[model samples]
Target: MTINAGRHFVTIDESAAGERLDRALAAALPALTRSRVKALIEGRRVALAGGQTIEEPSRKVKTGERFEVDIPEPEPAEPVPQALALDILYEDGDLLVLNKPAGMVVHPAPGNPDSTLVNALLAHCGNSLSGIGGVRRPGIVHRLDKDTSGVMVVAKNDRTHVALSKLFAAHDLTRIYQALVWGAPKADRGRVEAAIGRHPVDRKRMAVRKSSGRNAITDYWIEKRFGPPLHPIASLVGARLGTGRTHQVRVHLAHLGCPVVGDPVYGRKSRNAKAPAALVDFARQALHAAVLEFRHPTTGEEMRFATELPQDFSKLVQSLNSVK
Candidate 1:
């Protein structure tokens, strides 16, 4: 009944009878998570006493029977593991920090059922991820929108989850984003302090509100200008969040009359005005999470991570250069 790397046999007792197969296995083998047990069973790795393979996770357990589980090696895992590749920036026993690419949903939802960051982490980190609703699920403390790419940190266990959540709640960590906006800010540097909430007419869009919204702040500065300096057409801007809000950067920037380039929902000044075709006809929002800094939850070590702009973003910037 003890769980160690060496023990693989689970002998069911009267208390375990009628319990679900995966549940029983996880209770008996504490080293392996319930989700992992389910995967192993579905992968045809666990067998009953008479060598009969049990593939149903919900199968009821019977007393006085023994089940053997086959744990796969860490590397060269089989088809049971999701095949999505991960750009793991840093990993420890308690956390995983990575650069989540643009267009990938962070969590599984109705429209996005699989092939998400959580699914990939479930495969990549294996049994290391644990604790959600009393089962072993990845702890996603914060998330970026599917279209917004950036640096993110994921907790691997409950302790790390609590710590990271506290850090975000206090706004103790630093987050920086780089964006290509429609025009340069009036001033070199300025701050936007407003309240943000769901749009009254369009449920899909978020807007700055005078009332009935959470306080949002974004400090922005123009990094470079494109086109004639006196009357620039576009600018690359860096924005640091004073408060993390849904669509904070996009909505705040758009409120400033400088919507992010390629933002179809917000950059609606003039439709089909996507001039210079190459520079304007972007497929998704031209924003990226450029920098993230946080202290290690368990180790108290100062950690910082940054990622380069994707090829498309780089090319867009290059195209903007010629129009300068």
Candidate 2:
């Protein structure tokens, strides 16, 4: 079966103004993945005013600006019989890119084998999967945190799998993320160069340490600021990634004292005496895999994909806006 998606046109309104291009698309088209959105922008399928094309998914969209996109209609994936829904952004013979929602595990483990991305892919792709890193992941080239919803790329064949894996390992593949931080950043765009490693105290967490671990870098920009102690609500921040490491963006952002909103594990206690009542209510970490860009394995074409903020996140932002 052959799947061919279509093109979509979108306009930025007041509600979507200041949002990252990739993020707006993700929310606008829930079926498409973030990675696919970025690919479309990079491949010249996405146009911003005057037929001008954009390659940067993190580019901010102004109010009333119009943009165009091409969305693919994928073929009928072989039936494996799993009812789990998927946000497929782009698909072709050798690769697949998707926007994974928060709280959904990417792969199956001993305890979580039934409702994972792997299970859904198995059902959707059938026998067209390429094994990667052994049995744990069949076609998965990369993964996202269970609580982090964003873009992820997968391989459909062995050749594509090997090539994509090498690109990621060598840091050739570009990945960027957006996070809603509690505090404001000092600079609009600069590098947060730090070394990260497993937490010295916690076995499951990653931390920024003075010694040990690999190099990590994150860049951020302030999209909007709120709350003057006399007004209402809080602030919303945007960020981009320079390196792809385990929790690199999160840890670095937190290290700067601007931990993502609703991050129970790493976030500081709320400033407000009664914090849950605020406009923005984040039950989980407010982080998203906004964009993914790389060279296509089959066609050797450059591709990028992006996803927008989920409904829950969007609601929270609106609530915050209303508090003025």
Top candidate (TM-score): 1
What does candidate 2's lDDT look like per residue over 163-232, in tens digits?
A: 9988888888778777777756766566788987656544246788675566887777777765554432
lDDT of candidate 1?
0.80
Angstrom error at residue 273, model 1: 6.8
**Root mean square deviation (Cα) for candidate 2:** 21.1
Which candidate should be chosen as best, given lDDT against the real structure? 1
Instruction: For candidate 1, write residues 1-324 as lDDT tens digits.
Output: 434432277899999999999999999888778998999888656767434556689999999889877664442212233658888888888888898888998776556666788778878878767555133136788899888887999888888889998999889999999999887789989999999865644445678978556789899999999887876778899999989988899999999988998897887542434346765668889999999998998889999999999888888888878884
- Each prediction's TM-score versus the true structure: 0.72, 0.70
The lDDT values for all models are: 0.80, 0.74
Any runs in candidate 2 off by more than 4 Å, and if so which? 1-81, 229-234, 273-281
Lowest summed lDDT across 10 adjacent residues in model 2 is found at 72-81
What clash count goes with each model?
A: 1, 25
Clash count in backbone of candidate 2 = 25
